[model samples]
Target: MEERKARTVCCIGDVHGYISKLQSLWSNLESCIPRLDFDSALIIFLGDYCDRGPDTRLVIDFLVSLPFRYPRQKHVFLSGNHDFAFAAFLGAIPQPQDGSEFREGWKEYEMSEEREGWYREEGYQGMHLQGRRWAGKITVRFNTIKGTEYQGSIYDAEPTFKSYGVPHGSSDLLRAVPEEHKKFLTDLVWVHEEDNVCIETSDGVKTGRLIAVHAGLQKGKKVEEQLSSLKAKDTRIPKVEALSGRKSVWDIPEELTEPPTIVVSGHHGKLHIDGLRLIIDEGGGLENNPVAAIILPGLKIVRDTDPLVKQ
Candidate 1:
């Protein structure tokens, strides 16, 4: 019996609206991998597709065109914290099944509303907390942690508004965003699971289940419960921990250890690979950093600034 070739799987990190970097990285991936393999590869995009950079509109357009451009390739788009807020502001998130108002979820973060300048414009009455925050104006101009000047809001979402031809905090953004872009945001998944995924290791090639989320799964929680909440897109919770958590979600859940699942994510703003766990967000949406991607089986790392392709 002829042995089947292992399929190529590429997991791309946070783009944060840098169209040029994304284009360069895509070209580099093409140049580095064989054409036949690249065409049929499974491409998983770890989100944060909007904000921070100036080309969000173009970036979304590029992502939307991928399926048509590369018909043979399979693509999976996961929602990141930034993207979740973006979708919230666009009213793209599905309403809670319980029928509670989105504003009801704002109680926990209400204290920060005044300081963050949460959006209270024309259509803010029923807005989600993250949506208001995303479109809000912050009094402070600098971010101590990121060491970058605030781009109109704490989410640094001013660039996203500008990319759509609207001024920051303006309700005009409600209409400025295109329908296709809105659909793309609405369709983003919070969690993606793949069975029998092949990955390279020091020992050898191994096949196992793969779980891809934005930030990561919390370490101590029940994997099934967390997966349920994410799959339901429960907007009742003020914040989706898996998409925005920091240290809490840095490790894989103990439950998946028995079966040896590969957990991958891209929201930590750094590249880390340990055993079957991978964190691929090397760019962190900073102007100076380059976007990154990880090719499975071979476990090869590719960056936008690699200079692998000819100019």
Candidate 2:
């Protein structure tokens, strides 16, 4: 009997609308890996495809074309927090299953509305809180956290707006965004899982189940409960911690350890690899940073700014 070969999996980090970097990284990946492996590879893009940098429109176009361009490669696009808010503003997210209005979600964060300058434009009535905040203008000029000027809104979505040929905070963006682009945003998944994935550890290569989320699973929560909500794309909860959390979601759940599950994420703005946990967002959408990707089995990292190709 012959043993089956391991499949190659490539997990890409946050793009943040950098078209050139994404293109370079894509080229680099193809150049680094063997042609057959690259063609049939499972490419998982940990999301944040828009905002911060310029060329979001082009980035979406490139992503949308991947299926047609490489029919053999498997592609999985996970929704980032920025994308969720983008979809919300575009009225792309589905209505809550419980028959509650999207406005109901605003109450929890309503105190910050005025301060955040929540969008009260043409269609704010039925919009979600994140949508309002995404399109809203901020009162402050500087973003203390990122150490940069606030880019039109709290989400730094000015570039996204401009990419569609609209001015910052203009309600005209509703009509400006193309239908395909809207579809791309609407079709984004909250979470994805793969079985029998091979990961390289310092000790040796290990096979396990892998869970890819935009942020990560909370440390103490039941994995099933969290996955249920994520799978349902539950919008009732104002903030999906799994999609946009900080330290609380830094670690993998204890239950997953028994089965040797690998937890990977990209919303934390840093590259962290400890044992089976991988957080691969080196770019964080910053202009100076380079977009990154991690190739499985070998656990090698490929970046947009890498010199030419690997030796």
Lowest summed-lDDT stretch of 10 residues in model 2?
1-10
Question: What's the C-alpha lDDT at position 172 in model 2?
Answer: 95
- Give TM-scores for every candidate, taking all chains together and pairing residue i with residue i: 0.97, 0.97
lDDT by residue for model 2 (136-219), tens? 999999988889998989999999999999998899999999899899999999999998788776666777789999999998
Worst 10 residues of 1 by lDDT: 1-10
Residue 287, model 1: lDDT of: 93
lDDT of each model, Cα atoms only?
0.92, 0.92
Q: Tell me, what's the RMSD of every candidate?
A: 2.0, 2.0
lDDT of 2 at 226: 94
- Give per-candidate clash totals: 0, 0
Model 1 CA lDDT for position 145: 91
Error of 2 at 145 (Å): 1.7
lDDT of 1 by residue, 1-311 (tens): 11235679999999999999999999999999999999999999998999999999999999999999999999999999999999999899998889999999899888898889999998789888899999999988889998889999988999999999999999999899999999999999999998768887776787888999999999878899999999989988879899999999998888888878999999999999998889999999999999999998888999999979643
* Residue 192, model 2: Cα distance from true site in angstroms: 0.2
